[model samples]
Target: MRKLKKCLLVFISSLAIVLISYGVLFYFNFFQEFVTVKDNKVQWNNLPDDTFKSCYAPKLSFSSMPVTEISQTSINLLGNPVNNIKVLEKAQRYYIPLKSICTVLGFSLVKNNSEFILTKDNMNYILSNTDCIINGQSYSLRGNLIFYENKEYISISDIEYIFNLVADFDMNNKVISLLTPLSNSNKSENELTDGKVALIRLEDFSAESVLLSESGQMKFKIIGNYLNSQGIKYHIAWVPRYKSPSNNIDNDLLSNISIENVGFINTLDYLINHGGQVGLHGYSHQAGNNTSISGIELSHKYNSSEEATRSVLENAIDTASALNIPCTFFESPHYKATSKQKEVIKEYFQYLYEPNSILTFHKIQRENNNLFIPTPLGYVDNLDVSSIEKGLAHPTPGELASLFYHPYKELNFINFSKENFGVKVDYSSSSPLQQIVTSINRYNYRTIHVSDLKN
Candidate 1:
């Protein structure tokens, strides 16, 4: 009986050791799953995939009528006349030879088996029949491909959509003008002759009730004071009026930049005296039942007409001028403005503090009499450091590394060390804004104001 009891005790001890060993191994694997050390860099594992999602979808119906070759049309590529390419009209849609357009754009076109591949820089477009694959993503073409004289032809609309170029058709003059937002040649003499340039824009400063609060004022002061101390120039996108859609406030609430609001206007004056320049963001920064700061002020849904857009710009400019605030630039709220609205805005302001289009690079480019200075580095939402780094890495020589930041998010900027899944996450005390400025400096980009850019 004693011998049997000894054996049972030994067996139980061994079982307990095995269970503890298994638990330790499982815990280690779980910890490693979340935190990984790669190439001397610590990164969080199992994060969401950061692949680019295509906003474009295939058109529902494609035109398949008989083709009518238009021989008398004049082709203009980036304001330069092209003499070799002829336009084709099918079902009232204008099409141009793919190879000729590619040649002018400096993109390579190669036929691979049954598919035609078009490539330029990092963009790859594969064309097979009515199907199109851009950058490894499949989409449907709006019109059927035509083969003329052993060359493939695509519609002008497709060219604009795929290549991020603008196409203007003149029916009377038989002219089709193709324009890109950025041009390597014919650069403006007043453009940034310095290596690369960086501009910082502060967004969503308004007279809203929330922004007028003590907390809001403190946040703005912090950002303004920091930038001034660094000797960095920045632009304040100020909304002159605040209208709340939720409260059903139809009347406009003025920003009250006068001496009556001593505290707020004083802060503004201080910022201006330091290194801040004001830009007219929008008159109210909202349309109809939309709230300020969150709604688009000028878009197809509201204030889209040329007359209405002109009225808004005039009102905004007049208001700023009356306040003695020098606003030489205009930025559409949420960067949402129609083509007609942009044209009117260009007439009102010397510079546009936004991109010419969604696909255009963030560079200082001129159109007619106006200059567009886009924020290519984007904004610091939730302090996305990786995205800002990616933007800084992508721009070629002579491009702008501009970005914006919301002063209200200052409180969320804090350093902390927390353990998740048994791995320590040490967040740096440096804010994304500071990191961006540091990166820009490291890249040897000279910071400049939008007013300094010449058209």
Candidate 2:
């Protein structure tokens, strides 16, 4: 009996040691950092896959565009936006290549003698060199079917009518704006949320760029105070380190792996405190340069495949875990991640900031079962003035004018001064961030931080 008692005590001691070890590892994030640092990365399945699950605004897609602009909620398209549009001239009217629109816009076309028949989304129309028939109805047009460059050209204006598109031609600017209406239900949802959720993202808040300097912190403080003065909540993305995985740990991301200086910790605390909330901006935001991971984009650093993409994310998550940083959402540096990589990131993050989204009028785009919200105002670089103007006039009620600003800047929002941050904007009046702020306020867009979306 005494021998059995001794054996039981030994087992109890072993169990206690194991439990204590796990606790220590968790507190220090030792296992996440050390193991991953040693190339033993954590798997996405090991982490809890929890994110915000509520529905978002309307989504749009396109083939390409001449220039990027602010995201707008409008008659959204479905496919990549194409930059080059082919058009042919006819009797006093311009005819666009039928094949171009057919392929890009997903229309079905059938050729029968001088008459042409086309169908899309369950409707059919017939056109000839002189007349047009829609489903059976006849309509006269100033333009007609013309053949150019071995391809058929038709007055896109007529097709636009059939497609239920309203074109606003700015003769002064020579700009063509296509408008579409949302369903009553979708419009209701959009009106309730437009511009309500204002996201002031400080891109690359780590050692990779300039956030560590006094100037950078000053810029951060300026924006935070501006938001606070405006009564707005916001989000900040943090990087664990700013170099390759093999590089020695530095900055907020990998600080737990090593105790950082008081000044550094103070800066980090200031950023965490004054900033509305925190998120993951990728660890070692270096792309295509790290020997450990080899790609130009941070998410693609591991390689060009999905499996390699996931492992890179594993590196970020595990490192963040070690540091006790709650990475509620994710954004790629320079918006340089692949769709496959985004899927892998989706498995880890709740929401994603997608600037390089394959869509037009960059609104909240839902792809791969994940809500990819676009930063239409540029990454604190090239602000889309046209996109912003369109959103101001969007037929939908809510306008998510998600604006991105880096501390380092050649400004886009016109006449941006310090005092204007919190003031309500005049929707009819034109201004940079102020217009957005006013729109948010007027639309009842409850200014919210990204953390608000985290479940």
Give the candidate number with the greatest TM-score: 1
Q: Write the per-residue lDDT of candidate 1 for residues 1-455, one digit (tens) a residue.
A: 99999999999999999889877854543233212223323233222222322222222112334566776777787767767776776533567888888888888999999899999998999988777898887755544578877878986646655675544434446566665521111112232233445678888877655454443443454455456555566899988777786896543323322211322443454456446899989888988877888888899888999888877787776555443356758899988897778877876676789888643444455565566778867787776767877767676433456888886665455222212211122223387766776676565555567766531
Q: What is candidate 2's CA lDDT for residue 146?
A: 60
List the pairs of residues colliding in candidate 1.
Answer: none
Task: Evaluate model 2: give its TM-score.
Answer: 0.44
Least well predicted 10-residue stretch by lDDT in candidate 1: 416-425
Residue-by-residue lDDT tens digits, candidate 2, 48-155: 224435222212111110111112211212323434555433221234567666776677888898777788876787878756787787755434456555877655
Q: What is the C-alpha local distance difference test score of each model? A: 0.63, 0.47
